[model samples]
Target: MYKILIVEDDNTIAEEVGRYLMKWGYEVEAVTDFGDVLGHFGRFLPQLVLMDIGLPFYNGYYWCGEIRKVSQVPVIFVSSASDNMNIVMAVNMGGDDFITKPFDLEVMAAKVQAILRRTYSFSAPTSLMEYKGMILNLSDMTLVCRDEKIELSKNEYRILQTLFENTGKTVTREAIMKRLWDEECFVDDNTLTVNINRLRKKLEGLGVEELIVTKKGIGYRLGEL
Candidate 1:
């Protein structure tokens, strides 16, 4: 299912839109904290965003620009200001479409579906795992955080993928070795340690410190951020 983030200040409108989208099989999150819109956006990693132009705090245009710096996810402006200037500004600021207020929920759903189909149909679905604002794009083997992208080595990517798949749980060294062997890596205990250290350094370079926690006597697991 496609995930959507709704950035509207009006509680009633946000709830109505959220409910309508949910009924149509879309996973939706309505923004409640205006101060940290980008934080929520990064955490949710939604495929599309529904933003109201007039928002509390920094307004939708500012948040949309911030999102564009990290992702090319489709953003549709849903607002009461439907004037040509506002529409133009929305598009100029990276909005994909504009929806006037008082829109029909059915029409809105159809437009959302159409946009989603057009935006994602041509591209392979990207699988993502996120923790503490860090997002791992499994399809691209890239990590994104705070507008920074980090390329991962084969072993590093595999190790992180394993830990993310088993979030908040311990993964044994034996199991990791088995997976690496299956991938034809053929790493020994020492080699695994080297890889883990390298991965930790790379994560630290991206401002994530001590992400991989060693579970002495057991194995390794990701530390909760």
Candidate 2:
């Protein structure tokens, strides 16, 4: 299911929109605390965000810029400020679309659907996967932790992608090899060992030790931090 975040302050509007979106089978979260919008965002990691222009603590544009610094998740502005300047600013602030206040909920829902299709239907790489405070940016093939961007080679990316996809499960060596085969890479037992060692060292450098635990002749599993 695609998760959505709503950053509007008005109680009635937030609850109403949340109910409408929930009825459509979308997992929705409406922001209540205005002080830590970004913190909420990182935890929810919503695929899309519905923002309001006139928020309590900071405006939608400010929060949008903050989100852009870390993620490219699509943001659609739903606001009462329908002026041209505000609309242009919304787009300039990394908003995907804009909807003025007192708008039809059906049209809003349709816009949400259209934006989701355009962003995800083509399998766009602008998405993030987070595990144990480690965020993998598929778009850039980089792992971000504590503001550090660790670049991953093609082989490293493939291995980590496999592990992240399975999360808590133990991924067999043969399974990882199959993923590498799909990339047309020649990976043998020794080659997989070397790549695993390198990736582990990189993770350790970021103070994330024991993230990948070997299963003793079985395979590897993603362990707790």
Candidate 3:
């Protein structure tokens, strides 16, 4: 299912939209903290965003601009401001579409579906995985934290990719090796250990300590930052 983030401060509208979208088989999350919209965006990694202009801390346009910095994910501005100026500003700030508030839920959902289909039909959905505050950019094989980018080698990327894919579960060493093997790159025990150590050091440089925990007689699991 496609994930969507709703950045409206009004609890009622957010809940209503979230519930309506969920009924349509979409995974949705609403932002409660206005001060850290980008943080939420990084963590949720939504395929699309529904934003309201008149937020508490910073306006939706500002948040949209910030999101554009790290991601090209589609953003749809949802606001009561139907004025021409607001709409134009929304577009200039990287909004994919605009939905004026007091909107019919059906129309809102239709707009979401249309945008999602159009945005992802010809291209792959944005491949991003987030744990704690760290984001793994799967397409470019880089890890991002606090606005900094860290490049990863092929083996390093694959290792983190496997661990990120199984965040809440332990990924066995054999399973990780199999993933590498599937790519036709054989990884023995010592090589896998070296890769894991390197990955841990990289994570450490980002102030992430013990982000990867080794389970004795088992495999590795991602720990909280």
lDDT of each: 0.87, 0.87, 0.87
TM per candidate comes to 0.82, 0.68, 0.76
Candidate 2 residue-wise lDDT, 125-215, digit = tens: 3667777766776777888765466899987888888898899999999898888776566666888899899999998888788988999
Ranking 1 against 2 by TM-score, winner: 1
Clashing pairs in 2: none
Error of 1 at 142 (Å): 1.7
The 10-residue segment with the lowest total lDDT in model 1: 124-133
TM-score of 3: 0.76
Off by over 4 Å in 1: 35-45, 65-72, 83-86, 120-124, 181-185
Per-candidate clashes come to: 0, 0, 0
lDDT of 3 by residue, 100-139 (tens): 8789999988999999999999998767777776778788
Best by TM-score: 1
